[model samples]
Target: MQASNSPSLTRSQLATELGVSVFTLNQWAVSGKGPKAIRVGRQSVYRREDIDAYKATISSTESTPAPVSQPIGSYMMRLPEVLSLSGLSKSSIYAMSKAGEFPASVKLGSRAVGWPSHMVMQWLNDRMGNVA
Candidate 1:
């Protein structure tokens, strides 16, 4: 079930809530792994429900004394974080992008590139649904 108290979160906030380093989140985005995020124009946001679901899945698999209460969403990740989150290699991300199956990165500057963090998360969710 979704957490009613969970609130929309930015990539950085979600990363903190997940206890994952920002670097990790970026990898997930670039690699096309992790949870689905949303784009509000140039800003990115993650749904609290999605974060809670992901945490539940991960926490349930671990052999712990008890599960802790976690915020549904509270972080906002960058492209590098998504790449790490997804575990897809750079080439793989590029290939997926070329095929239009993965979220495409934008040219941030002359040499900088980035993807929508929320979109990367969505791709991950889609993959999970298909696998199930």
Candidate 2:
């Protein structure tokens, strides 16, 4: 539990500060790898000190530089490829696409659709909090 006087950040604010999406933060929380959080009523909050310590740990352990941005050319990714890269179920992808949460697929032919490769890579980078 955090002290009552400590400053805290909401999940959304922390995600923005870390250059990642809220969904990514949620995944981290579930995996038990993110900064510790304190529950405040219905919300989860991160103490400023905890966030700072988490960043320090990451910076100290990471040896490689951040990933570069996706290449300039556009390429299409079929469903199987998308699933492999994203680790999301086909239904989740379609549901997220329909809800405008995930990138929409492009129509390749009468019955085929594919996602842009660059977009998928960008999304993955964003989720990994790798700014490029």
Candidate 3:
């Protein structure tokens, strides 16, 4: 992770890294939902270090997020990628998604779509809670 003194990143870049819309991240800034951003003249930027710090904060605050080796909010993933990461069959994933038992996918194009890696992670955490 870069330090607080690292170079800055545009909002678009951060949005891609976190698998969220730029508009959503902008909302986070306005609503104080995500990490604090740096303002360079008329642009909003953030340091890599700040993002890492924010992840650390989230990880620490979560009490019992499943038993996964890593937090869900760390990366973006596609459907096939998610299947591999989760070890769930494709049919099960679709059923879960329809039942709101999983995160919804975001449309990338007319035919292409993807889900945020973190949402899948959160869903996994939620599943762990249902274990009997």
List the candidate 3 regions with Cα displacement exceeding 4 Å: 1-6, 63-132
What tens-digit string does per-residue lDDT give for candidate 3 at 46-129? 887788888799888978657545363465577899898778898988798889877877778898878778788777787778
- RMSD of candidate 3 to the true fold? 12.4
Alpha-carbon local distance difference test for all models: 0.75, 0.87, 0.80
RMSD of each: 18.5, 14.0, 12.4
Q: Highest lDDT: give the candidate number.
A: 2
CA lDDT for candidate 3: 0.80
Clash totals for all candidate models: 39, 0, 1
How do all the candidates rank in terms of lDDT, highest first?
2, 3, 1
lDDT of 2 by residue, 18-107 (tens): 789999989998999888988899999999999999999998998987874657797889999999999999999999999987899989
The candidate that wins on TM-score is 2
TM-score of 2: 0.45
lDDT of the structure predicted as candidate 2: 0.87
Which lDDT value does model 3 have at 33? Answer: 80
